[model samples]
Target: MTAMEANTDEGVIDAHHHVWDLSVRDQEWITGPEVAPLRRDFLLADLKPEARASGVTATVLVQTIDIPEETPEFLAVAADSDLVAGVVGWTDLTSPDVTRALAALRERPGGEYLVGIRHQVQGESDPRWLVRPDVLRGLAAVAEAGLVYDLVVRPHQLAAAHEAARLLPRLTFVLDHAGKPPIASGELRPWADAVRLLASLPNTVCKLSGMVTEADRDRWSVEDLRPYADTVLDAFGPRRLMFGSDWPVCRLAATYAEVIDAARELTAALQPAERREVFTRTALRTYGMTFTGSQAPQEAPCA
Candidate 1:
Protein backbone atom coordinates (compact mmCIF):
# COMPACT_ATOMS: atom_id res chain seq x y z
CA MET A 1 0.00 0.00 0.00
CA THR A 2 1.05 3.57 -0.56
CA ALA A 3 2.03 5.84 2.31
CA MET A 4 -1.32 7.61 2.13
CA GLU A 5 -3.07 4.29 2.56
CA ALA A 6 -0.98 3.17 5.52
CA ASN A 7 -2.36 3.40 9.02
CA THR A 8 -1.30 6.36 11.15
CA ASP A 9 -0.39 3.91 13.91
CA GLU A 10 3.31 4.04 13.02
CA GLY A 11 5.54 5.92 15.49
CA VAL A 12 7.56 8.97 14.40
CA ILE A 13 11.05 10.01 15.24
CA ASP A 14 11.48 13.75 14.74
CA ALA A 15 15.11 13.72 13.68
CA HIS A 16 15.52 17.47 14.20
CA HIS A 17 14.08 20.06 16.63
CA HIS A 18 15.53 22.57 19.09
CA VAL A 19 15.02 24.01 22.60
CA TRP A 20 16.56 27.16 24.06
CA ASP A 21 16.15 29.50 27.02
CA LEU A 22 16.86 33.25 26.78
CA SER A 23 17.39 33.52 30.53
CA VAL A 24 20.45 31.27 30.21
CA ARG A 25 21.85 32.87 27.03
CA ASP A 26 20.66 35.36 24.47
CA GLN A 27 19.84 33.86 21.09
CA GLU A 28 21.51 36.60 19.12
CA TRP A 29 20.32 35.04 15.88
CA ILE A 30 16.72 35.71 16.81
CA THR A 31 16.50 39.30 15.64
CA GLY A 32 14.55 41.51 13.23
CA PRO A 33 10.80 41.68 12.56
CA GLU A 34 10.69 38.46 10.53
CA VAL A 35 12.07 36.41 13.43
CA ALA A 36 10.34 38.21 16.29
CA PRO A 37 8.18 35.16 17.06
CA LEU A 38 11.28 33.13 17.95
CA ARG A 39 12.77 35.68 20.38
CA ARG A 40 10.95 34.04 23.32
CA ASP A 41 12.32 30.97 25.10
CA PHE A 42 11.34 27.51 23.74
CA LEU A 43 11.67 24.96 26.46
CA LEU A 44 11.24 21.16 26.19
CA ALA A 45 8.14 21.37 28.35
CA ASP A 46 6.52 23.54 25.67
CA LEU A 47 7.27 20.95 22.97
CA LYS A 48 6.46 17.66 24.74
CA PRO A 49 2.64 17.57 24.49
CA GLU A 50 2.56 18.96 20.95
CA ALA A 51 5.13 16.40 19.86
CA ARG A 52 3.40 13.49 21.56
CA ALA A 53 0.03 14.36 20.04
CA SER A 54 1.63 14.42 16.60
CA GLY A 55 2.81 10.78 16.97
CA VAL A 56 6.39 11.75 17.71
CA THR A 57 7.58 9.29 20.33
CA ALA A 58 11.16 10.54 20.16
CA THR A 59 13.13 13.49 18.82
CA VAL A 60 16.71 14.61 18.30
CA LEU A 61 17.33 17.91 20.10
CA VAL A 62 19.59 19.95 17.83
CA GLN A 63 21.96 22.79 18.70
CA THR A 64 20.87 26.39 18.18
CA ILE A 65 24.14 28.24 18.84
CA ASP A 66 27.91 27.93 18.94
CA ILE A 67 28.15 28.22 22.71
CA PRO A 68 30.45 25.76 24.47
CA GLU A 69 28.05 25.40 27.40
CA GLU A 70 24.87 24.58 25.44
CA THR A 71 25.64 20.96 24.53
CA PRO A 72 26.22 19.79 28.09
CA GLU A 73 23.10 21.58 29.23
CA PHE A 74 21.10 19.93 26.42
CA LEU A 75 22.51 16.58 27.43
CA ALA A 76 21.20 17.18 30.94
CA VAL A 77 17.80 18.09 29.51
CA ALA A 78 17.73 14.91 27.44
CA ALA A 79 18.61 12.82 30.49
CA ASP A 80 15.48 14.08 32.24
CA SER A 81 13.06 13.84 29.31
CA ASP A 82 11.35 10.84 27.77
CA LEU A 83 10.92 12.53 24.40
CA VAL A 84 14.50 13.55 23.68
CA ALA A 85 16.37 10.42 22.61
CA GLY A 86 19.43 12.03 21.00
CA VAL A 87 21.20 15.37 20.80
CA VAL A 88 23.18 16.92 17.94
CA GLY A 89 24.99 19.65 19.86
CA TRP A 90 27.65 22.17 18.90
CA THR A 91 31.34 22.75 19.60
CA ASP A 92 34.12 24.74 17.89
CA LEU A 93 35.17 22.61 14.96
CA THR A 94 38.37 24.62 14.56
CA SER A 95 39.54 24.24 18.14
CA PRO A 96 42.85 22.40 18.40
CA ASP A 97 41.54 20.46 21.35
CA VAL A 98 38.42 19.13 19.54
CA THR A 99 39.07 15.49 20.37
CA ARG A 100 39.57 16.24 24.04
CA ALA A 101 36.51 18.46 24.00
CA LEU A 102 34.42 15.66 22.48
CA ALA A 103 35.74 13.25 25.10
CA ALA A 104 34.90 15.65 27.89
CA LEU A 105 31.37 16.06 26.50
CA ARG A 106 30.99 12.30 26.43
CA GLU A 107 32.05 12.09 30.06
CA ARG A 108 29.48 14.66 31.21
CA PRO A 109 26.18 13.51 32.74
CA GLY A 110 23.63 12.33 30.11
CA GLY A 111 26.53 12.39 27.63
CA GLU A 112 25.63 9.04 26.09
CA TYR A 113 22.68 10.81 24.46
CA LEU A 114 25.21 12.81 22.37
CA VAL A 115 24.62 11.35 18.91
CA GLY A 116 26.21 13.99 16.65
CA ILE A 117 27.89 17.41 16.42
CA ARG A 118 26.85 20.36 14.24
CA HIS A 119 28.40 23.74 13.50
CA GLN A 120 26.70 26.73 11.94
CA VAL A 121 28.79 26.39 8.81
CA GLN A 122 26.16 28.31 6.86
CA GLY A 123 27.01 31.42 8.91
CA GLU A 124 30.73 31.22 8.12
CA SER A 125 32.12 33.72 5.63
CA ASP A 126 34.36 31.12 4.03
CA PRO A 127 32.48 29.25 1.33
CA ARG A 128 34.64 26.17 1.65
CA TRP A 129 34.71 26.21 5.45
CA LEU A 130 34.08 22.50 5.95
CA VAL A 131 37.10 21.45 3.88
CA ARG A 132 39.51 23.67 5.76
CA PRO A 133 42.34 21.72 7.42
CA ASP A 134 41.43 22.47 11.03
CA VAL A 135 37.72 21.86 10.44
CA LEU A 136 38.45 18.63 8.56
CA ARG A 137 40.62 17.46 11.45
CA GLY A 138 37.80 18.19 13.86
CA LEU A 139 35.35 16.29 11.64
CA ALA A 140 37.75 13.34 11.64
CA ALA A 141 37.83 13.46 15.42
CA VAL A 142 34.02 13.47 15.44
CA ALA A 143 34.05 10.30 13.33
CA GLU A 144 36.61 8.72 15.66
CA ALA A 145 34.25 9.35 18.55
CA GLY A 146 31.62 7.21 16.71
CA LEU A 147 29.30 10.17 16.20
CA VAL A 148 27.46 11.49 13.15
CA TYR A 149 27.95 15.03 11.74
CA ASP A 150 24.93 17.17 10.79
CA LEU A 151 25.43 19.60 7.89
CA VAL A 152 23.42 22.81 8.20
CA VAL A 153 24.39 24.57 4.98
CA ARG A 154 22.86 27.12 2.68
CA PRO A 155 22.16 26.10 -0.95
CA HIS A 156 25.19 28.01 -2.24
CA GLN A 157 27.44 26.13 0.20
CA LEU A 158 26.36 22.62 -0.90
CA ALA A 159 29.36 21.97 -3.08
CA ALA A 160 31.65 22.48 -0.11
CA ALA A 161 29.39 20.11 1.84
CA HIS A 162 29.69 17.57 -0.97
CA GLU A 163 33.49 17.83 -0.92
CA ALA A 164 33.57 17.55 2.87
CA ALA A 165 31.46 14.38 2.82
CA ARG A 166 33.64 12.98 0.05
CA LEU A 167 36.72 13.63 2.19
CA LEU A 168 35.26 11.91 5.23
CA PRO A 169 34.00 8.57 3.91
CA ARG A 170 33.70 6.95 7.33
CA LEU A 171 31.63 9.72 8.83
CA THR A 172 27.86 9.80 8.39
CA PHE A 173 26.90 13.25 7.05
CA VAL A 174 23.25 14.30 7.42
CA LEU A 175 22.10 17.21 5.24
CA ASP A 176 19.63 19.32 7.20
CA HIS A 177 16.61 20.84 5.41
CA ALA A 178 17.71 19.36 2.07
CA GLY A 179 20.32 22.16 1.94
CA LYS A 180 17.61 24.79 2.39
CA PRO A 181 16.32 24.97 -1.20
CA PRO A 182 15.10 28.19 -2.84
CA ILE A 183 11.40 27.47 -2.55
CA ALA A 184 10.50 31.07 -1.78
CA SER A 185 11.50 32.15 -5.29
CA GLY A 186 10.60 28.79 -6.91
CA GLU A 187 14.17 28.50 -8.20
CA LEU A 188 15.55 24.94 -8.59
CA ARG A 189 18.67 24.99 -10.64
CA PRO A 190 21.96 24.68 -8.80
CA TRP A 191 20.12 23.72 -5.60
CA ALA A 192 18.68 20.56 -7.15
CA ASP A 193 21.98 19.72 -8.89
CA ALA A 194 23.97 20.34 -5.74
CA VAL A 195 21.64 18.18 -3.59
CA ARG A 196 21.92 15.39 -6.18
CA LEU A 197 25.71 15.60 -6.05
CA LEU A 198 25.80 15.48 -2.26
CA ALA A 199 23.40 12.52 -2.18
CA SER A 200 25.62 10.60 -4.58
CA LEU A 201 28.06 10.21 -1.71
CA PRO A 202 27.42 6.88 0.08
CA ASN A 203 28.00 8.34 3.51
CA THR A 204 25.39 11.11 3.39
CA VAL A 205 21.69 11.36 4.40
CA CYS A 206 19.10 14.13 3.98
CA LYS A 207 16.39 15.46 6.27
CA LEU A 208 12.88 16.18 4.99
CA SER A 209 12.69 19.19 7.30
CA GLY A 210 12.81 22.98 7.16
CA MET A 211 11.26 23.18 3.70
CA VAL A 212 8.24 25.06 5.02
CA THR A 213 10.43 27.91 6.30
CA GLU A 214 12.36 27.93 3.03
CA ALA A 215 9.17 28.37 1.05
CA ASP A 216 6.86 31.38 1.04
CA ARG A 217 6.22 31.38 4.76
CA ASP A 218 2.90 33.20 4.52
CA ARG A 219 1.36 31.02 1.79
CA TRP A 220 3.13 27.79 0.94
CA SER A 221 1.46 24.72 -0.51
CA VAL A 222 2.60 21.09 -0.68
CA GLU A 223 2.91 21.65 -4.43
CA ASP A 224 5.42 24.42 -3.76
CA LEU A 225 7.71 21.99 -1.95
CA ARG A 226 7.29 18.87 -4.14
CA PRO A 227 10.11 19.54 -6.60
CA TYR A 228 12.87 19.79 -4.01
CA ALA A 229 11.40 16.98 -1.91
CA ASP A 230 11.07 14.78 -5.02
CA THR A 231 14.68 15.50 -5.97
CA VAL A 232 16.04 14.27 -2.64
CA LEU A 233 13.72 11.26 -2.67
CA ASP A 234 14.96 10.32 -6.12
CA ALA A 235 18.63 10.85 -5.23
CA PHE A 236 18.79 9.36 -1.73
CA GLY A 237 15.73 7.06 -1.75
CA PRO A 238 13.77 6.26 1.42
CA ARG A 239 16.63 4.67 3.36
CA ARG A 240 18.77 7.80 3.28
CA LEU A 241 15.96 10.26 3.94
CA MET A 242 14.49 10.98 7.40
CA PHE A 243 11.78 13.20 8.86
CA GLY A 244 12.60 16.27 10.99
CA SER A 245 10.30 18.91 12.44
CA ASP A 246 12.76 21.86 12.51
CA TRP A 247 10.16 22.95 15.11
CA PRO A 248 10.01 26.38 16.67
CA VAL A 249 12.07 27.10 13.56
CA CYS A 250 9.33 25.55 11.42
CA ARG A 251 6.94 27.74 13.39
CA LEU A 252 8.16 30.49 11.11
CA ALA A 253 6.03 28.83 8.41
CA ALA A 254 4.01 25.96 9.95
CA THR A 255 2.87 24.51 13.23
CA TYR A 256 4.41 21.14 14.25
CA ALA A 257 1.25 19.19 13.30
CA GLU A 258 0.91 21.10 10.02
CA VAL A 259 4.50 20.31 9.11
CA ILE A 260 3.91 16.64 9.90
CA ASP A 261 0.77 16.60 7.77
CA ALA A 262 2.58 18.24 4.88
CA ALA A 263 5.34 15.65 5.04
CA ARG A 264 2.75 12.87 4.96
CA GLU A 265 1.12 14.45 1.94
CA LEU A 266 4.45 14.81 0.15
CA THR A 267 5.39 11.20 0.74
CA ALA A 268 1.95 9.75 0.03
CA ALA A 269 3.21 8.27 -3.22
CA LEU A 270 5.74 6.01 -1.51
CA GLN A 271 5.12 2.43 -0.34
CA PRO A 272 4.37 1.79 3.32
CA ALA A 273 7.84 0.41 4.05
CA GLU A 274 9.42 3.46 2.43
CA ARG A 275 7.18 5.68 4.52
CA ARG A 276 8.41 3.92 7.62
CA GLU A 277 11.98 4.59 6.56
CA VAL A 278 11.35 8.32 6.31
CA PHE A 279 9.29 8.44 9.51
CA THR A 280 11.12 5.92 11.64
CA ARG A 281 13.92 3.59 10.48
CA THR A 282 16.35 6.09 8.98
CA ALA A 283 16.50 8.20 12.17
CA LEU A 284 16.87 5.08 14.27
CA ARG A 285 19.96 4.13 12.27
CA THR A 286 21.38 7.57 11.53
CA TYR A 287 21.58 8.76 15.12
CA GLY A 288 21.82 5.38 16.90
CA MET A 289 18.95 6.67 19.02
CA THR A 290 17.49 4.73 21.91
CA PHE A 291 13.85 5.46 22.68
CA THR A 292 12.22 5.02 26.09
CA GLY A 293 8.49 5.04 25.27
CA SER A 294 6.44 1.86 24.75
CA GLN A 295 5.86 2.84 21.12
CA ALA A 296 9.58 3.07 20.43
CA PRO A 297 10.94 0.61 17.92
CA GLN A 298 13.82 -1.71 18.71
CA GLU A 299 17.31 -0.19 18.25
CA ALA A 300 19.23 -0.96 15.14
CA PRO A 301 22.92 -0.57 14.31
CA CYS A 302 23.86 2.48 12.26
CA ALA A 303 24.10 1.85 8.53
Candidate 2:
Protein backbone atom coordinates (compact mmCIF):
# COMPACT_ATOMS: atom_id res chain seq x y z
CA MET A 1 0.00 0.00 0.00
CA THR A 2 1.12 3.55 -0.60
CA ALA A 3 1.83 5.67 2.48
CA MET A 4 -1.05 7.78 3.66
CA GLU A 5 -1.43 11.02 1.79
CA ALA A 6 0.19 14.06 3.43
CA ASN A 7 -2.16 15.47 6.05
CA THR A 8 -1.80 18.05 8.80
CA ASP A 9 -3.71 15.83 11.22
CA GLU A 10 -0.85 13.32 11.39
CA GLY A 11 1.77 14.23 13.94
CA VAL A 12 5.21 14.53 12.29
CA ILE A 13 8.62 15.23 13.62
CA ASP A 14 10.73 16.75 10.83
CA ALA A 15 14.03 15.13 11.80
CA HIS A 16 16.03 17.48 9.58
CA HIS A 17 15.75 21.08 8.33
CA HIS A 18 17.53 24.43 8.85
CA VAL A 19 16.87 28.10 9.49
CA TRP A 20 19.39 30.85 8.81
CA ASP A 21 19.72 34.61 8.75
CA LEU A 22 22.03 36.17 6.15
CA SER A 23 22.32 39.28 8.30
CA VAL A 24 23.85 37.27 11.15
CA ARG A 25 26.51 35.46 9.10
CA ASP A 26 27.27 34.83 5.46
CA GLN A 27 26.16 31.26 4.65
CA GLU A 28 29.25 31.25 2.44
CA TRP A 29 27.95 27.88 1.17
CA ILE A 30 24.94 29.61 -0.37
CA THR A 31 27.07 30.95 -3.17
CA GLY A 32 26.33 30.40 -6.92
CA PRO A 33 23.12 30.87 -8.94
CA GLU A 34 21.67 27.38 -8.54
CA VAL A 35 21.08 28.02 -4.84
CA ALA A 36 20.21 31.68 -5.37
CA PRO A 37 16.69 31.07 -4.11
CA LEU A 38 18.06 30.41 -0.61
CA ARG A 39 20.17 33.60 -0.56
CA ARG A 40 17.68 35.32 1.74
CA ASP A 41 16.86 34.75 5.41
CA PHE A 42 14.85 31.61 6.36
CA LEU A 43 13.78 32.47 9.86
CA LEU A 44 11.22 30.55 11.96
CA ALA A 45 8.46 32.97 10.95
CA ASP A 46 8.85 31.92 7.32
CA LEU A 47 9.06 28.19 8.07
CA LYS A 48 6.42 27.97 10.82
CA PRO A 49 3.40 28.30 8.56
CA GLU A 50 4.82 26.15 5.78
CA ALA A 51 5.81 23.34 8.13
CA ARG A 52 2.60 23.54 10.17
CA ALA A 53 0.47 23.43 7.04
CA SER A 54 2.39 20.32 6.01
CA GLY A 55 1.72 18.44 9.31
CA VAL A 56 5.07 19.06 10.95
CA THR A 57 4.37 19.24 14.68
CA ALA A 58 7.99 19.25 15.76
CA THR A 59 11.29 19.77 13.94
CA VAL A 60 14.98 19.38 14.40
CA LEU A 61 16.79 22.58 13.38
CA VAL A 62 20.11 21.45 11.91
CA GLN A 63 23.29 23.50 11.74
CA THR A 64 24.28 25.07 8.42
CA ILE A 65 27.88 26.11 9.13
CA ASP A 66 30.85 24.92 11.18
CA ILE A 67 30.80 28.04 13.31
CA PRO A 68 30.81 27.79 17.13
CA GLU A 69 28.35 30.64 17.58
CA GLU A 70 25.66 29.14 15.33
CA THR A 71 24.57 26.46 17.81
CA PRO A 72 23.79 28.90 20.60
CA GLU A 73 21.83 31.06 18.22
CA PHE A 74 19.87 27.96 17.10
CA LEU A 75 19.19 26.98 20.70
CA ALA A 76 17.73 30.44 21.25
CA VAL A 77 15.54 29.97 18.20
CA ALA A 78 14.31 26.59 19.45
CA ALA A 79 13.60 28.01 22.88
CA ASP A 80 11.38 30.68 21.39
CA SER A 81 9.62 28.69 18.66
CA ASP A 82 6.73 26.30 19.21
CA LEU A 83 7.49 24.28 16.07
CA VAL A 84 11.19 23.66 16.68
CA ALA A 85 11.61 20.71 19.06
CA GLY A 86 15.36 20.31 18.91
CA VAL A 87 18.57 21.90 17.68
CA VAL A 88 21.48 20.01 16.10
CA GLY A 89 24.26 22.58 16.29
CA TRP A 90 27.87 22.47 15.21
CA THR A 91 31.02 22.78 17.29
CA ASP A 92 34.75 22.17 16.85
CA LEU A 93 34.84 18.38 17.16
CA THR A 94 38.64 18.29 16.80
CA SER A 95 39.32 20.64 19.68
CA PRO A 96 40.54 19.51 23.10
CA ASP A 97 38.13 21.98 24.61
CA VAL A 98 35.18 20.33 22.88
CA THR A 99 33.70 19.21 26.20
CA ARG A 100 33.96 22.71 27.63
CA ALA A 101 32.35 24.16 24.53
CA LEU A 102 29.47 21.70 24.78
CA ALA A 103 28.97 22.51 28.46
CA ALA A 104 28.96 26.22 27.73
CA LEU A 105 26.31 25.65 25.08
CA ARG A 106 24.18 23.68 27.55
CA GLU A 107 24.28 26.58 30.02
CA ARG A 108 22.90 29.05 27.50
CA PRO A 109 19.33 30.36 27.91
CA GLY A 110 17.81 27.89 25.48
CA GLY A 111 20.46 25.22 25.84
CA GLU A 112 18.02 22.46 26.80
CA TYR A 113 16.90 22.37 23.19
CA LEU A 114 20.38 21.35 21.94
CA VAL A 115 19.90 17.72 20.88
CA GLY A 116 22.89 16.84 18.68
CA ILE A 117 26.03 18.05 16.87
CA ARG A 118 26.92 18.06 13.16
CA HIS A 119 29.86 19.05 10.92
CA GLN A 120 30.20 19.35 7.17
CA VAL A 121 32.14 16.15 6.70
CA GLN A 122 31.13 16.17 3.03
CA GLY A 123 33.28 19.25 2.43
CA GLU A 124 36.34 17.81 4.17
CA SER A 125 38.84 16.48 1.65
CA ASP A 126 40.03 13.77 4.01
CA PRO A 127 37.89 10.66 3.65
CA ARG A 128 39.04 9.34 7.02
CA TRP A 129 38.48 12.60 8.86
CA LEU A 130 35.86 10.99 11.10
CA VAL A 131 38.31 8.40 12.42
CA ARG A 132 41.13 10.84 13.05
CA PRO A 133 42.30 10.56 16.67
CA ASP A 134 41.34 14.12 17.60
CA VAL A 135 37.93 13.82 15.98
CA LEU A 136 37.26 10.50 17.68
CA ARG A 137 38.15 11.97 21.06
CA GLY A 138 35.75 14.82 20.46
CA LEU A 139 33.08 12.35 19.38
CA ALA A 140 33.58 10.53 22.67
CA ALA A 141 32.97 13.83 24.37
CA VAL A 142 29.77 14.25 22.41
CA ALA A 143 28.64 10.79 23.48
CA GLU A 144 29.49 11.63 27.06
CA ALA A 145 27.26 14.64 26.82
CA GLY A 146 24.46 12.33 25.60
CA LEU A 147 24.18 14.07 22.24
CA VAL A 148 23.84 12.40 18.86
CA TYR A 149 26.43 13.06 16.10
CA ASP A 150 25.06 13.93 12.69
CA LEU A 151 27.24 12.82 9.75
CA VAL A 152 26.88 15.04 6.67
CA VAL A 153 29.24 13.20 4.36
CA ARG A 154 29.43 12.23 0.71
CA PRO A 155 29.28 8.65 -0.61
CA HIS A 156 33.05 8.27 -0.39
CA GLN A 157 33.01 9.13 3.32
CA LEU A 158 30.50 6.42 4.27
CA ALA A 159 33.17 3.87 5.05
CA ALA A 160 34.85 6.21 7.52
CA ALA A 161 31.45 6.95 8.99
CA HIS A 162 30.91 3.23 9.43
CA GLU A 163 34.29 2.91 11.12
CA ALA A 164 33.54 5.93 13.30
CA ALA A 165 30.34 4.28 14.46
CA ARG A 166 32.28 1.07 15.06
CA LEU A 167 34.93 2.91 17.04
CA LEU A 168 32.55 4.94 19.14
CA PRO A 169 29.85 2.40 19.75
CA ARG A 170 28.19 4.67 22.25
CA LEU A 171 27.67 7.63 19.94
CA THR A 172 24.49 7.57 17.85
CA PHE A 173 25.58 8.57 14.33
CA VAL A 174 22.76 9.77 12.06
CA LEU A 175 23.68 9.51 8.36
CA ASP A 176 22.28 12.63 6.75
CA HIS A 177 20.64 12.33 3.27
CA ALA A 178 21.41 8.59 3.15
CA GLY A 179 25.09 9.48 2.78
CA LYS A 180 23.88 11.46 -0.25
CA PRO A 181 23.45 8.69 -2.82
CA PRO A 182 24.16 9.25 -6.53
CA ILE A 183 20.46 9.40 -7.40
CA ALA A 184 20.97 11.73 -10.35
CA SER A 185 23.26 9.14 -11.91
CA GLY A 186 21.00 6.28 -10.80
CA GLU A 187 24.06 4.28 -9.76
CA LEU A 188 23.61 2.59 -6.40
CA ARG A 189 26.37 0.00 -6.14
CA PRO A 190 28.84 1.57 -3.68
CA TRP A 191 26.36 3.96 -2.16
CA ALA A 192 23.89 1.19 -1.51
CA ASP A 193 26.55 -1.16 -0.18
CA ALA A 194 27.99 1.52 2.10
CA VAL A 195 24.56 2.53 3.37
CA ARG A 196 23.78 -1.09 4.20
CA LEU A 197 27.13 -1.42 5.95
CA LEU A 198 26.46 1.62 8.10
CA ALA A 199 22.89 0.54 8.77
CA SER A 200 24.23 -2.80 10.00
CA LEU A 201 25.70 -0.94 12.91
CA PRO A 202 22.99 -0.76 15.56
CA ASN A 203 24.13 2.66 16.71
CA THR A 204 23.47 4.31 13.37
CA VAL A 205 20.36 5.80 11.68
CA CYS A 206 19.72 7.41 8.24
CA LYS A 207 17.62 10.34 7.15
CA LEU A 208 15.23 10.06 4.18
CA SER A 209 16.00 13.49 2.83
CA GLY A 210 17.76 15.60 0.19
CA MET A 211 17.02 13.12 -2.59
CA VAL A 212 15.33 15.73 -4.82
CA THR A 213 18.42 17.92 -4.95
CA GLU A 214 20.57 14.85 -5.39
CA ALA A 215 18.51 13.75 -8.39
CA ASP A 216 17.77 15.56 -11.66
CA ARG A 217 16.31 18.48 -9.76
CA ASP A 218 14.55 20.07 -12.71
CA ARG A 219 12.88 16.82 -13.80
CA TRP A 220 13.08 14.51 -10.80
CA SER A 221 10.11 12.51 -9.56
CA VAL A 222 9.36 9.96 -6.83
CA GLU A 223 10.42 7.23 -9.30
CA ASP A 224 13.90 8.74 -9.50
CA LEU A 225 14.30 8.53 -5.72
CA ARG A 226 12.69 5.10 -5.12
CA PRO A 227 15.78 2.90 -5.36
CA TYR A 228 17.82 4.92 -2.90
CA ALA A 229 14.83 5.23 -0.57
CA ASP A 230 14.19 1.51 -0.84
CA THR A 231 17.80 0.78 0.02
CA VAL A 232 17.59 2.69 3.31
CA LEU A 233 14.16 1.29 4.14
CA ASP A 234 15.33 -2.28 3.62
CA ALA A 235 18.53 -1.68 5.52
CA PHE A 236 17.45 0.54 8.43
CA GLY A 237 13.72 -0.17 8.34
CA PRO A 238 11.20 2.49 9.33
CA ARG A 239 12.14 2.33 13.00
CA ARG A 240 15.64 3.61 12.30
CA LEU A 241 14.79 5.76 9.27
CA MET A 242 13.34 9.25 9.78
CA PHE A 243 12.00 12.03 7.57
CA GLY A 244 13.93 15.25 7.03
CA SER A 245 12.94 18.10 4.73
CA ASP A 246 16.51 19.39 4.27
CA TRP A 247 14.54 22.61 3.69
CA PRO A 248 15.81 25.86 2.27
CA VAL A 249 18.55 23.77 0.69
CA CYS A 250 15.79 21.59 -0.73
CA ARG A 251 14.22 24.80 -2.01
CA LEU A 252 16.90 24.67 -4.68
CA ALA A 253 15.04 21.71 -6.19
CA ALA A 254 11.46 21.60 -4.84
CA THR A 255 9.20 23.49 -2.52
CA TYR A 256 8.92 22.40 1.15
CA ALA A 257 5.50 20.83 0.52
CA GLU A 258 6.81 18.98 -2.53
CA VAL A 259 9.61 17.47 -0.53
CA ILE A 260 7.16 16.21 2.11
CA ASP A 261 4.81 14.87 -0.55
CA ALA A 262 7.61 13.04 -2.35
CA ALA A 263 8.78 11.46 0.91
CA ARG A 264 5.25 10.23 1.63
CA GLU A 265 5.04 8.76 -1.86
CA LEU A 266 8.38 7.01 -1.43
CA THR A 267 7.28 5.36 1.80
CA ALA A 268 3.82 4.56 0.54
CA ALA A 269 4.26 0.81 0.84
CA LEU A 270 4.92 0.80 4.57
CA GLN A 271 2.23 0.06 7.17
CA PRO A 272 0.73 2.93 9.17
CA ALA A 273 2.70 2.10 12.34
CA GLU A 274 5.95 1.78 10.42
CA ARG A 275 5.32 5.07 8.64
CA ARG A 276 4.65 6.64 12.00
CA GLU A 277 8.02 5.44 13.19
CA VAL A 278 9.68 7.14 10.22
CA PHE A 279 7.69 10.33 10.56
CA THR A 280 7.69 10.69 14.34
CA ARG A 281 8.87 7.84 16.59
CA THR A 282 12.37 7.50 15.14
CA ALA A 283 13.18 11.21 15.43
CA LEU A 284 11.84 11.51 18.93
CA ARG A 285 13.85 8.45 19.98
CA THR A 286 17.02 9.39 18.11
CA TYR A 287 17.00 12.93 19.43
CA GLY A 288 15.59 12.12 22.89
CA MET A 289 12.77 14.63 22.38
CA THR A 290 9.49 15.10 24.22
CA PHE A 291 6.45 17.24 23.46
CA THR A 292 4.20 19.19 25.79
CA GLY A 293 0.55 20.23 25.57
CA SER A 294 -0.89 19.87 22.05
CA GLN A 295 2.34 20.09 20.06
CA ALA A 296 1.88 16.46 19.11
CA PRO A 297 -1.51 14.81 19.48
CA GLN A 298 -0.17 11.54 20.87
CA GLU A 299 3.29 11.68 22.41
CA ALA A 300 5.55 8.66 22.14
CA PRO A 301 7.52 7.94 25.27
CA CYS A 302 11.02 9.43 25.05
CA ALA A 303 13.94 7.06 24.66
The runs of at least 3 residues in candidate 1 whose Cα sits more than 4 Å from the true structure, single-residue gaps closed, are: 1-10, 290-303
- Off by more than 4 A, model 2: 1-9, 293-303
**Candidate 1 lDDT, tens digit per residue, 274-296?**
88889888887888753343553
Every candidate's lDDT: 0.88, 0.86
For model 2, which pairs clash? Answer: 2-268, 3-268
Candidate 2, residues 10-127, lDDT tens digits: the string is 5687889998888889999888888888899998898888887787877889999998889888888887776777889999999999999999998998888888999999999999
Query: How displaced is residue 225 in candidate 1, in Å?
Result: 0.7
RMSD in Å for all candidates: 5.5, 5.2
